[model samples]
Target chain A: MNDRIYMDNCVTSAMAPEVLEAMKPYFGEEFWYPGSFVSTGEASSAAFEGFREVIADALNAAPQEITFTSGGTIANNIALKGLALAHSGEGRHIICSTVDYPDLLTHAAYFEKMGFEVTYLEPDELGFVSAQKLKDAIRDDTILFMSTMVNHVVGTIQPIGEYSQVLAAANHKIWFHVDAGQAFGKLHLDVKALGMDTLSVSAHKIHGPQGIGALYVKKGSRLGAYIHGIKRFEGVQPGGLSLAAMAGFAKAVEIVYKDLDGSIKQLRELSDYLLEQLESQIEYVELNGPRGEGRACHNINVSLDFIEGEAITIMLDMHKITVATGSACASQGLKPSYVLLAMGKNQVQAHGSMKFTLSRYNTKEQIDFTVAKLKEIAAILRERSPLYNAIKKKQEK
Target chain B: MQYSEKVLQHFMHPQNVGEMENPDATATEGSPACGDQVTMYLKVDKENLIIEDVSFLSYGCASNIATASIITEMAKGKSLEEAKKITWRDAMEALDGLPPVKAHCSVLAADTLQTAISNYEIAHGLKEVPDFSKETIIGELKKIIYPQVGEDIITLKMVKYVGFEEKTGEVLIDLNLMSFDQYRDNVAEEIREHLQKYPEVKDIKINFPS
Candidate 1:
């Protein structure tokens, strides 16, 4: 139905057709080094910097403050490791949510290796880490605080603005970084508006080309470069940016937010329809993330009892529908999701977790097909589960 | 997960997916907490000591389901001795190949099969059943003493269960140890050496529950 339903947008979205068209000239006709002083090089650099201006304008920051990164993970690494190294003399303590993007948590481990202390804050039952928790965690030696604006697994929108306000009122000399990779295009993210000193966004998550992202490092923030190179990225990342990818990123940003209100409404309608159908038709299925406000408008995560998520994904994949499971089977570690565990879910419930992220291109028909297929698969799996049989026997008695 | 073609084929159409009502022996292994478990049901031939019918109900990834399906097919119509010898490697070979990480799924399936047979031996009390009682085994184990506990093994209550088959004289004792692991081998050897003197005890197995 409708050219193979794709519900894995949080993994990566399809490059927008308009973005591809905008990037064509940069790849073929204007394919010169952006660093040269010749006419062609000047033309290419001007076009590349013009896209950078689009990013700066969207985030309400100066052009110099925006640094083009390889992608979300690299952007996150630069923020966490970069700040940790630069501010080591000032302090050695850092704080972040346990359910933050893996790149952020991994860097926190690296910080620990370097003798820096890290505190991982657990989120509420609905996966919301409030500003009060962030406030209570601040210490005198706290050098940096980083958290994702929207969780990648559950899509629970954190209170980035209020958390930044708490840090501001405390007036502590801690650097604040927001991993806005999942929230930048969907949510109206302005670095100044959110009172955040630094933030990072990945372009591929919003229908832009892969391998391109941007990090807004506010003026006067001290950050040391981990990647040693000469003169490129002001020696921060020390590499050249892909001119075509940046052009596609800018064009995708424009296409997605062209009618921002309309696109958001569409996302909400599709998301709500899926949740409603699953709740009405399925038994023993529970939503893993929040429902209305504070939850992402285009994402839904659910956990079905007496079943496994990897089986569900594979069954759906056989039906030409794509989705993602957060089960240990889906992970390389062969253990349940640490994110779901941090959210207070037991291992069995966490093993049954599945995430569906809608895009601007998804439709109601696709969700209906997915929900219908899920009902059949869940029933079959439950029938074959000994735990399910025992529970049914007990209930019957 | 880079699953083998054989795994996908079996998972798509699992054989004997449900359980039997009051089968000869049924055992559940693994847990939902670990995301891999299977409960095997066996109907053994009372006269011949062969597994006549077998089925499984599992909760795990594709490998778990596929391994259960294949192991049950391999175990059915085979002697209890042959079935007990099926290893995780056999399950993987039967599956053609499995992802290296998912090798545990094969292990879980084979372990569950052995568990079902043990449960059969425990549940069945035939006319040919041995006269050995739980107290008799405990009395025999009392001959061995652990240095750390400074007492006979029975007083420590580490021996949780004892099952003996009359026809084969097979004895199984489950141990729940409270001491460190380094001394376990020595303690086990002393018990095995003591039990060996009884010619009626044809086979003996010492198992510790993790």
Candidate 2:
């Protein structure tokens, strides 16, 4: 019966009101198959292509190079698998960081099965891969360099611009892919400035409708096709994307950039307040990701000793507060976050990891309320942990 | 997120959510690889060979807690020998079957129960558990988790018997279990697929008589 408080923005955001309003006409009166020659359909097609131009302009890429897909997962799949296949003859070896999103990892796994070699380079203890190490990782036959704009679990925003420059200097025109699903709307992304051959973005992460996302493919990039269908989005994405959803996604991006500074300031202040409260109000807790600007502006991850992440998540849910956990039990893979593990956390530490991602809509009041609930839950769960009890007993001596 | 009704009932109102003091035996099963763990305690009547009571603490997902809770429900009054026959499949069936992805939660519960039983066996100096196979049981179990494709049961420490006749091509398993006297055959079906592939394992028998 408590008020619902959502801290799972990294998972998905509620659609922005402006986005909803823009998409309304498309759902009913403006419903038409894009690219059709008929009047209504032609109008729909123009609008669809118009947003495509807007997104391309945002990324500083040619409109012809922008392709729409189902969402972040599909965008990533196309980028990784498509580029790997397209460049296999150039070399079978690929350089990738361990903190890459699981979707990219899964695709790397598939590539490995196909006889392409992938080197899973680990980042430093702070979830960072140095440019020098990345450059050194480039083998003579290394065909691609893939990482993410941000670490999904801990919100460590990878320095994409620096790493892309390293790759460019190491191997000219090497396929550099960045899965920017979490970072796209929160951070400024320019394909030219970052020197990235491809980048992936999802609409829902920016308060747009689900099932709509875009990939910025550099104009000269030789990316192959993954899905076999009509060349709907410039011969890359097969099958048509949801026209209404695409319009909604474009408006979402517009509103995000139009109010970019204000939103960023609000989210930064909100997350900063949360971290301060969590640190000052709780005991036996440690933040997982980097502390300040090195991290994403919208998220925070912390590990609480003597308690499982799922236990805390469930307990918090009972109080009408929502967050996310990557503990073995919390994940569908039944694995602790490889991202956290690669960053040097032990099993227990990884199992206790909890993440809270904020949105522009979040308020200072919600952070205070959630922190109070977390303190209460931590005390109760610590009381149940035998390890905590044993440690207390030993301390008594 | 769409858990079964049974999972919701057990997770929302979990039973035996604490530890016991001075237990006859205790065991913990968890791996850094999975990031989930369950530590179980047992109070056993050594002379009568019954599991008097059981309790557990888990750092895992909803299924992990639910599965552990249900196993304690199933094993509370059972004999230790009977409790040893409790399989993860029993817990799966009791919860009306876990989501396939969460099947491992029941496997964790079952494995931890076996580890607790083994701990009991060690503390009381009961005779070492009978060999599950002619070959070193641990080595053969390393080849697989169950008779099926999941986790390897050897590392899980739940293998009870593996009988193979080279000449007659007959394979039999005592089949480690954590619950459900009636769910033995379902587990058997999984084992049959695993062992039946071999030219030597012409016939397979999983003896779980309820």
Candidate 3:
């Protein structure tokens, strides 16, 4: 097949066929606006309820607890800043990892600007954070602990479940939020089981329409104290909804959940085959994030030293393969990714990090072809690079 | 992302990359931490005010790396005065286009060219070249330590070398602790602070482990 081998799924995924089909009715037949209409309109409130049920089921939460937002960014903003603002009276301390998405950090900064103390914890070289370290950082003034389930750049899955236990031991009152845009559908997440108060997910990352996402708030949670919108999401998320996009998101989540085990296995196999192909062809390739079972199956952050990542990306594009250097949101930046830096990577390695994420549609042949093309381009670039040759010769001894 | 044909052309096949034999002036910039490095070599015809040759070695992102290579092509054969005036705007235009953020990299290209020209003048002794080498750096420290140990570079092996960057004229050194802990430990910092007192010394080379 001539399908373009896209490995930047962590940025945004292509809409699933099933998601498109489910959304078709909303764009055409049942196109009524959900806000002002009466009972007999072309679209009914039931449409939104249906979407809510699907998302709640996928999240293992009560349907009433799910609140829709524009995307992961907005969901994270509301969850983090809102919780901080609401609970500042109880405790002014907020803890976040230095490697978190800047959007979430920006929200934390808003809390800082509002007179709350914020601590940005740094991760280890493997991009893993210890629960003990987080507990040590926490104090009596700590009101919330926020982190990522999957780091957007390195794709290192954090021990959020373990951190949850640490938080519970300290005080059940501390709110925990996870930005799982890169991990939601790919990895298993059960909000209550993980002892999370707020969870952010994006439709685009899960093969649904773009610019649509949802946040999960546990039932009877006091998130209402932090929320400020025209209409209260039981006092937390206070915005109207995108019914059509939410419907598509709902369908996408349904499809993903229905085939979760099979899709996970397929993704694991595809990632394995691709990683093997890369390893066999490219010498001196350093895989970032975790070394084996500790990593997320969908993310493989590889650094081919001496060759710049932007160059590798362009050459791969020439081969009709799409991948990302660091997070898609941060790609426009010139500085090396802060996420990789927090993991103790020097500047060159951080700037050279590339994320390869696989979706359900990637085939084995495509992976092989991509590997062959990457090897050829890397070899050509290395031959022309004096830096690479110098480093190679020095290490040869 | 479709780059202009000019960008692709320059990126795919840049001209004047690598070294020149016995260059009159050389400049290296960028950091391995930042995932990019560039070294530029210049041969200036002093009598004619012409740049006889210019070459570069870059380890960086595709566009900047390519931009560095293309810069030499644009600069070659131009007068020293003309090459110094080459702005990042001109190079970006020559490449057809570069991302706005990478525009800073273009400035790095311009700065390297200027620094190379300046280094040429200094290396040729057309201007006063400052000496911040380990010998001179240690000489300054000996003046401070001579009062205590009465020993200098010729006498003792107290100095331990750490690291050095040749292009930027920067160096780091360490003075390993002997059996005694209080045997003049602030020599490194004292030397570093003293070196800043001299303007001609563009950078300080240090020795650590004391």
Candidate 4:
């Protein structure tokens, strides 16, 4: 009971002890801003570049191409707005999918309000915004196309390679930006192979400290200054980012990338076991996203029928288990998950949807315990549910 | 926002929960599509016109279950007239308080209780089936809480006008909510769900202060 089982890694995760250890010195006696002439400044500058290199190596990007930002949202803002402002003179049309992360969708809205034309492509039932749709939506005036590499809600991994080819085949240059906040450590990302003009990745998603993320800008690509301030770290979005967090971010990246495939496999196996246990123990459960390799490794979303999600989440919370739900009742705005809705789920399904994002820290025993408790909780909630009773009565007849 | 300790108590272990067999009257309110629904059962003492027993089954969130549990507790042993007088606010007060967003759950619970009582009265020939009119629409609208404030839209003066066409069964409402209001969609959705339950309402059109 003392150990809480946390499965909401998609939101955030427990920072690794090693990352904290790496960050301790930067927070203490060795703290110094990057500068020149002085030995302290030179040492700090060298350390900063080394940290940048670690993040760059994870994405197969050059160190100079990566700019450390405050977080994923900041990186997204800098990339999307900067790309739009830099290339707006050529065209004002932007393309994004309905099921993209809010970072990209909100930017699309802002671009629309700024008098730019936005084409919002709809995702398929499994939350796949196909590359063919991107190709079709492309126009001569399309200046930028934004996408989420891995959907934050359903974990559907978009075809970045195909998207890159589609944009490349276009007659004109259409700056491509990707919100890879969910994809950074969970999947293999190569900026050169993917050919995206700009991409954003966050550190906290991979057991790093919060408040630090990086943006990759392809060489020869120009970005208009979005954050105008003193030149500190990277000139792209000039501001003072936490040097200690950067060190921790690099350590987190190093640990994950040390055996990226092994880490992904571990997550996939845990999530698979979780899904299998849930299905075996529970009745009338339905998986919400892609079933196998098509989905990201860490996420397993499902909708349990005859009960609402908030009640189930609360019951699980009582047992010291944390999970996420798409229920409108649990949301601040009282709206169901837009990603679930856009994936063609009904209100009932969306309300019943539960998302379990596993990490390397999760275990088979934890999954089993979670499923067992969830089974009992589901039974209790169902017994108290009018919806379940109505359906049972119908089935009886 | 967090639920009160009392709310968590009732939600975790709700009282008078589950279906009641041989109920004198039963009524269901809200809808599955709206992410919440409650069914209430009542057993009234015909001679004394007192509610002998009351129970509820909810297909909603924690607050929804808590509100239903509290509403039943409040209605038990009370006269049918007294039970009908019980409002959502009283239930919220009894539960200490609910979050502003979850305040609508209390409304659903209380509405179901009142409807069950109304059903009992009509079945026992104590009252006639109420006529459906603009006033009925207004009464239903009063049950729709503006989640931002946990108050009825009518009480907040958010409902600028309400109109109903008797011949066409069309309901039209003009809300003072701005286009940018975060709760605008929620309010509109609740209004439609509330009115659409009435057989007289054929169509609903809600206009915001765009």
Best by lDDT: 4
Q: TM-score (chain B) for model 4?
A: 0.97
Could you tell me how far off, in angstroms, the CA of residue A189 lies in candidate 3 after the best superposition? 1.5
Query: Lowest lDDT 10-mer window, candidate 4 chain A?
Result: A232-241
Error of 3 at B195 (Å): 14
Question: Which scores greater on lDDT, model 3 or model 4?
Answer: 4
For TM-score, candidate 2 versus 3, the one ahead is 3
CAPRI tier of model 3: acceptable
Q: What C-alpha lDDT do the candidate models reach, one value each?
A: 0.82, 0.78, 0.74, 0.92
Query: What TM-score, computed on C-alpha atoms, does each candidate reach?
Result: 0.85, 0.79, 0.80, 0.98
- The C-alpha stretches of model 2 lying farther than 4 A from their native spots are A1-3, A33-38, A225-228, A232-236, B1-56, B67-97, B107-210
- Order of the predicted models by DockQ, top scorer first: 4, 1, 3, 2
Q: Per-residue lDDT for B1-210 in model 2, tens only?
A: 357889867876778778788988898776433445678999998789899999987656667778888998898989988998888878878987765556756776777888798779877888675444446333334434332334555556566777777678777677666445233343444455435534555777666434
RMSD in angstroms, candidate 2?
Answer: 7.6
Worst 10 residues of 3 chain A by lDDT: A326-335
Better of 1 and 3 by lDDT: 1
State how far residue A131 of model 3 sits from its true place (Å): 1.3
Fnat, 2 decimals, each candidate = 0.65, 0.39, 0.57, 0.94
lDDT of 2 at B170: 76
